[model samples]
Target chain A: MNGGLRHILLALLLLTGLNPAHAAEPIKIGSFLSVTGPASFLGDPELKTLQMVVDEVNARGGVLGRPVQLIHYDTGGNASDALRYVKRLIRRDRVDLIVGGTTTGDTLAVIPEVEREGVPLISLAGAIEIIEPVKKWVFKVAHTDRMAAAKIYEDLNRRGLTRVALITGDGGFDKSGREQLRQLAPEYGIQIVADESYGNRDTDITTQLTKIRASDAQALINFGFGQAPAIVTRNVAQLGIDLPLYQSHGVASQTFIDLAGPAAEGVRLPAAALVVAEQLPDDDPQKPVLLSYKNRYEAQHGPVSTFGGHAYDGIMIALAAVERAGGTDKAKVRDEIEKTQSFVGTSGIFNMTPEDHMGLSLDAFKMVEVREGVWTLVENAD
Target chain B: MLEQLFQFLVTGITVGSLYALVGLGFALIYNASDVVNFAQGEFVMLGAMTAISLVAVGFPLPLAAVAAILITIGVGLALERFAIEPSLGASVVTTIIITIGAAIFLRGVALLIWGKDFHALPAFSGDAPIHLGGATLLPQSLWVMGATVLLVVLVRAFLNKTLLGKALLACSVNRAAAQLVGINVRVMLRLAYGLSAGLGAIAGILIAPITFSSYEAGIMLGLKGFCAAIIGGMGNPMGAVAGGLLLGVLEALGAGLISSGYKDAITFLFVLMVLFFEPTGLFGHKSADRV
Candidate 1:
């Protein structure tokens, strides 16, 4: 009986080895995203974009003549789930690279794992901490919150609106945005006249807005994510606060405009050029890439968001590095990614270096105003 | 400075009216059955979300609002019949636990139906702001306040004047005694649930324009309404309304005049002080219990 089992096992092994001519070894790319939870708005678009680009790449003869495989897990917005999935990606799937981490919390949770496992990670989150104290194997494609702050400050400075009132939500993203805006105010010759914060789940913010209306702020800056910013927009309109209102990139999606309704008109925010892709000047380097992505995505999905733009850049950057390194050698890809320069992407033209992993600058952001319920590029503010 | 205070008051009163409406629902249910209905907020959420969905599907505003309230009442009655009635003889803590479980289940169902996106209802009136003495007010604020006052009076009259209302109050005082007096205790419980659900639905429809609504929207509103009921002596409807207004005004004034960062902290601290000074609540009367 033992001899018969051994002969059968040897015959099975030989049969599997004989079928190797099906295709070249696939390049496995893993991801963990918050695709069905509170952060699903961010992750859903990101997953779609990644899937779309991977299909398009494979259709174009695949990357490095091998089909690209995306092995993804839905984390449901839990940081612990993200860490577990990242470990599984590295140890089980044996993916060459990872291109996800839909939130700052999830990205930060998996940094140590990616570093230890010697797999490169391309995060799609927007936090300064993700790249400031740079991890060796970790990189992000989204603009830092600090860059968003600086871009807003630049617009305010150009418009001669020096005194700013700040209304913030007490969530992690909003708190970080408020801090960046506050810390960068002095550099742009701006003064924060009033500072008010509300709870993340607080239904009413009229009290805070009343105080802001009572202040002598020349411009108002509201930093928050999710539904709070839309509520703030409505309250600002209701309170009749006439100052120029500025929001962070946190509320850059089309959903914000829909939720805020007409009150969203005239509100300005620093956002990726992907938002106003159709309106971008023809000479703009990002217009072609943005339009192509916007068209491709909107054809499959109903609407295109900047979050999806981040993922598109992430996979493209990863593939570019793989090409430059001649293989998915982790260390070589890391070196090539660090040496990247002038790579035009949906978010911006990236110029990576050892010192600056998130290579996009403030110019990657465009100060766009809501005009008649649509994004109008604010040329003078730039 | 005075204008700022007035603005804060306007904002506070608008916000308070919502809390009062929700608190009144809590008071109504607690009075009818000694069990606090933790799913009260889900009623509010279901009302607004259903109304919004109805309007999206071609129903007129008034029709949608009425239909949404009826649907919410049905849900409340169903909850009582299916979940609470089966466990009628359970301890108060167990009943409360059941209601909490029901609340979570309702929230999960809402998530499945409406997803996690925040949805808004158009204002009943125009979205124009009325400027008065260097402050501004949305027309919807007036609607909220006016409707709240009317509902408070109506609810008070219902409890004091109607025979059915008296039956509900009789249930609150002593369930065994109420059952002995030829009252259908189960029917009274069902009535309490339905009435409170209607009240919660109205509150949701009124505030949807101002606050927006989501599957999880009821969590904070419910907590604040519970605080209102607790601060105003848990079983007293009028007291709960008063407690809600007081909480709203204090929160607004504190955030406006003091530190905005400490707004929630200040409100909870005040609630704690009230509880410390009077264990029976500020408006609660001393009662002797016989074993």
Candidate 2:
């Protein structure tokens, strides 16, 4: 081999060897989320928030006098990518803590690897499947789909709509949706009429809509993400179907409006307390925290905040726990997180327990309506 | 029950027309040049977005739609000349992979240029849901179905009747022979690609009113159309149409009778079963070797 090339190769190896020892000097945290993919809409916001919180903590004299170093990967919302990035973070990056990934499928897929590695893994998505088997190292910051559904049912019970038809995509979000809504329907005096489900990639749902139109339902509840909800909105409008559409929190974005046009107006749904804090006045209790986070995030990144709030909450709690631990010991940090009590978060007051990795409950669901391209709070606290 | 059945059929036919149009474009390219242009979906996306942009800028419907189709045709010819001809005589799978890579590149370019916002192509007719015999159908959907049927007939006539079309088919069958027969096979290849892109652009424009336009919307639509082509065989125009319509019906039935959750699964399963059991396809000729 040439002398210059040989020297370069040796230097690279030496740098690689010195990198991990370098990583340990700074309290390292890893983040993996869908910076690109179907769930990128959710992951992008979370990533923005994660970077924001990391910056904030570092500026405030990071935990234990060591600034937190964040290593991140884009999982692309693929389970295989999650496994790959998990391996990369643990084996290569040598991160002390791991946070993120915004989809149920990816989070659940990586549970086995997280356990095998024994690194503290906190999920940004809650599919109910992630925390149930209870791996020693796994914790989740997002509320489970079941809890979200339960909250919706309780809130809608008082609403005059008795029969509701569903239009949902056949995806991971739809799975928990069917289970939770089906079981919770009778409890709320709501009957599911003419429910329709389309594929995750299906572009049209006219057949489902026609059936939905013929039904005696007074309202439509959509459970899906992105284009699915938007497609439904446009289709319903094009078909001249006038039923009020209540969408899953997954549809909380301008993406729907961009796709659905004027059809997006007046749609009702449940969302995180923070994202729609615009509906709450300046004097509202939740306004200050949400606005501050939103402003800081927009200034740092752009105007997108979904998993950003969850991630911000996740990092804050994780850092708080690390401080309570007085060190980066995994168990002590976990213990401190478990004892989180009424900790005001972008979503709600999170009070996590050892038994429950997800601190917030169904009570976190806040009813909101889209009016003139803006999401407004609908007062329905069941 | 009857209402649900009606709804499912309307949904199936509207979406099926789009798949058929896209599959027909694939068939045209495959038949003429023996190349599967997997970037057919990008043409569709480009058409939709182009039309949407023009409409957003207050252009007339006919002008925007025509511009979209012409632009796509230009893109197709450009791609065939630069990418396909250079890699001519390559293996089928290699061409397919190249096209897939091209699809990714096109998607990235679209994102970089237009951003990742979903946009709707305004319906030519005003938004009024028309009820036809207990079934509600959108006006845009009627236009799509009408356009699809028209394209099918137009394609059949053009391929069977036109001298250029005959020359193109002759090239597909025997390029060297066609060249000896005083046919410019290179021009035929360009013609095939341009026509394919034109047809896909039409589908993109026709369906944009309902499906809306986005940079990445073409990915799933392309996959579904490709699956339809698989069911129909790669090169047969009739098979492509039949396969598209059949898959649409199957998806509708799956959505209506069975769990709506398994619609795509059923369509994929149908494709798999056909490939496994009847590799020649429902109506396609043995254009290539199978095994």
Candidate 3:
């Protein structure tokens, strides 16, 4: 072969090896989470986690030898906002990979962009349906509503609680939670006595709780995240109902404890163990991951909240996949993430496989009961 | 069915009480100065935050509430003297723009001063639920309904029995004529703003316990108040009260009977229908002015 042909072949090999996706001056990673609006409670943490991952990676010398630059957009809890911001990040800002959004609806809203552009979107929110209907280049790092419901049912069965009364909010998120819980409750041999709902922003849940109080249900299942759950927690306490109150995964919020005040005690909920991260034993894998993230988070944003911790997990995993892929090749990174096993996540150890994007099982979570305005692990020594 | 109706009533009355309070401010300012203080919701936000902070700082509830009301009054009077007075007799639209600007400005200040998190508040009476005749309610709801009614009644008496209130009414009706009769119309307008803002503060504190107080809380409270006034009839206090209550009930019924997702849509649709069919509103009287 001629010398010129040899040189051309050598340069081509180098181009393929370098992975141009990560070589574009600065490897740009873009994300959209609700930094403002109703879902900010969830978005703020995910944004922080995204910030944490980027900072950590860049500090160690950027992903693929290019300094990692993160592009963040605030979706403001609006689906349109998610769509608009993602479009802006892709079309206007020209980011490499996107890795945010904290609700099923938000991730769903950005699915079109993820499809059209063939860019990987590692969503922090999970409705399960976001990827199930038609998965192109989307993956979730959080448990699905159905999965969470099944876990709750499993927990209830273990406790031998049979009758439940559901009081959820009237919103997309709450409605989804209610449906999933309802479908899964019968499987665990639990009967729902009464189901009631209030607006997402409704502060006063006395009437709803009163109905539940009068019902024959042994326990009340308050669904939905954000202010409504907190209101329910306080209302249940104030109304003086003695029935064991079981909250959906929605109560992982530290804001719930604050809003419920002393009323929060005795309310139990199933959550990924970050809420109990402080109580986890030293040398536990979950402890190191959660503590390191918490310390970094408190330094950057001040204090640690589990609601935000969920977001931190989503971003950390996505960045890891991007690093493994050595570039922003959407399909290659997604494949790498699918093969991720024993990857320590903020919520728990995530082990993704071909069948599941969210690899953590029910055992990965612990039931947390509110005590003294903080979530404590339920005293089930097992 | 009775239980359902009763529950809806409770929700409506609780929410409506807030609207009535805001509507009272609009009615007072409109009747006294022929202008709507668009920043009326800011007064509600200010009152709630001020009282909650004071209560948090170990101030007695009564003292904190009084301080909030007085501070709101001062704010109203100061706003009239400095901001609204300059635009006096300007086009109604111009005045509205000024109020909108003020509302946005006040919201910015609130976010800066109070931060964005919702603060917890204890109900005036501890959270023990009160059951009456097969219906259960929060004691705070009772206080809200009672406070709203009392304030409306007191405002009526003030307009009828007090010299200042009469002068304010006279000024709103005929500014030139009232001034010719040696009434200080500007001071009356200032008093109207003060009373309007003060009532908003009262509503804010009452509702704060029920709904956690936050920076952007008042804007929605104020918009609903505007709707309440429109429903009751502008320039009518009794109409405002009735309108606020009516709107709240409608919203509750819509939420319970229809789709909660479309609850807001139902309320706004009704407002549009009312505006289309009854421009002057049910209780509001028509007023004619020469150009």
Candidate 4:
């Protein structure tokens, strides 16, 4: 470092240390999110929720008697960019902990960096692989695709739809969801009679649907995100397929309904309580939490997606860990995060453990159906 | 058995019509200026996004579609003037690279204007499916197919029968000779861009309901359309339309009968086979015709 800059940094540190009213330095929380790219739908709200939560925390006299500083960078959904920014967050910004990575690719790309640096990272991405086999110093708030698959299977079992056909998109999220569904099918007493896939950018999936139609499957599950799920919804209707259609939580937002138009009617999916916050019972523990997050987010950002709710749970979990740790010690904070238990947040009641970094279970997801162009809770998880 | 094949055929034809429109656009610009406008896909995206925006602002669907097509045509003309025309006398490879740059710029502009959200345009007709002997077809699919037939006929007539169209063709035949015959080569090139843009917009508007429209939607459609042009013969408009239909049918059958995983691979393998057997494309004429 230059002598002049080093001296200036030392002087600023001394000034903060000398201040009587606020002796403790601000705790630095770093983040890198896909705020402006194709996955912005996930990262934009994530960034917003992080900023809003940090602001609210600061307004409430900060965490542990010190101001919280959020140092964030927009990775634009690129994995390499996410890694570079994360390294900078650790080496340059010297943040105490991190609480972002909008997509699974971004999260996985920075996993090795955060692990080596011993910084606590609570990712917002949904892939189970992020936390599977338990990487120390890493936790994620979003319910993995495995949870989504189990929740859907639970719903299917309730309805006695034993034979299920799978149509998946050839994308990461869909491919993972497809794998989880296939692996968990036997456990759920469901048979995978037909399994087909389509390209992400395919315009027509009728041929695949037709093949599925010929199968004796009693239900259809589409594993995909983006507009492909919407297209599948439409094609199912056009082909006169009478089987029940279930979509993955990857498309739990109203944008899916808007894109699918009337075809979204009667489609079921496993989603967070945030999507149907108003419909939750008054006695439900997550009701107040979901409603507050929904109202606060919608008040400023127009709508609330489950993606943003994941961020809410993530930052809240991080701050709660920091408070429990009593200081910005990375090791202590990591342990505190792993010991998180029954913390009611928007996505679910997270109960992190040393073995399971992602604390959400099948109960975290509520089965929802599209009724009259709005999300209606089908079954509330107890 | 046969029912499955019939269903695949119906679906293939409906999707093929869209590829034909976009492939026809590629063929038009290629024939006019010998520069493969990679921005052709952006034209499709612009058309769909513009129409959706127009409808959102309370324009009727038909009127919005017309305005969208006109707006996309304007974008095409602007692209030709600002990006393509400026690099006059550049190598073919240079001009092609310029179009790729144009495509990226157009996509960026679209991302800024439309954001990253996928916007849906309501179907031109009701989405009620018509049962064709156990096979089902959407009303929008009919609109797409009928519109494709009408457009292909219109474009063919304009190119083969009209004076201005013939002048455009003459430029493709021999730019220097056409210039000597008092043909305004620049005007012909501009017309090709305008016409190609209009075709792309119509394709976008027609398929937006089925596929939905987003800033990135054009990338795949454009690539498929380019493949259609290649399979048909780059310079052959009729060949492009046929190539598009053939590719779509092959893809559908490949997915349905063989494996969905190899759908694209199978289609590309066929394309490669054709390219290997017939380097001039399925319908491309020999060099004697150009001379």
What ranges in model 2 sit over 4 Å off? A1-24, A55-65, A112-118, A132-136, A160-163, A186-195, A212-218, A237-243, B1-4, B53-67, B114-117, B227-239, B258-262, B265-291
lDDT of 4 by residue, B205-229 (tens): 9889888989988899999999899
Ranking of candidates on lDDT, top first: 4, 1, 2, 3
Q: Which regions of candidate 3 fall more than 4 Å away from where they truly are?
A: A1-13, A16-24, A238-240, A329-331, A379-382, B1-12, B57-60, B74-83, B175-186, B247-278, B288-291
| Model 1 TM | 0.91
In order, candidate lDDTs are 0.88, 0.79, 0.79, 0.89
lDDT of 3 by residue, B61-109 (tens): 9999999889888887888888889987787778878888888888888
Could you tell me which 10 consecutive residues in candidate 1 chain A have the lowest summed lDDT?
A4-13
lDDT per residue for candidate 2 within A1-382, as digits (tens), equals: 3566445534544655654344325778988898788787788788878877888888886766568989999998898989899899989998877888788888887888878877778888968778886667788877677776766665566666678887777777876887778888887787887777877667777767766777788888888886778878877876678887788887776667667777788887778877687767677665677888888888866665556788988888888887666556666676787788877778777877777777777667687877888778888533
For residue B88, model 1's alpha carbon misses the true position, in angstroms, by 2.5
RMSD (Cα, Å) for all candidates, in order, is 5.5, 7.1, 4.7, 4.4
Docking class of 2: medium
* Cα-lDDT of candidate 2: 0.79
The Cα RMSD across the true interface for model 2 is 2.2
Candidate 1, fnat value? 0.74
Kindly list the per-residue Cα lDDT of model 4 for residues A1-382, writing each as its tens digit. 3566445545644654654444457889999999887688788888888889989999887876678999999998899999999999999999999999998999999999999989999999988889887999889999889988998899888887799999999987888999999999989899999999999889899999999999999999999988899999999999889888999998999999998888899999999988888888899999999988888888987788899898899889989888787667799889999999999999888888889898777788889999999989986433
- Candidates 1 onward: DockQ, in order: 0.67, 0.51, 0.34, 0.82
Q: In angstroms, how far off is B242's CA in candidate 2?
A: 4.2
Give fnat, all candidates. 0.74, 0.72, 0.20, 0.93
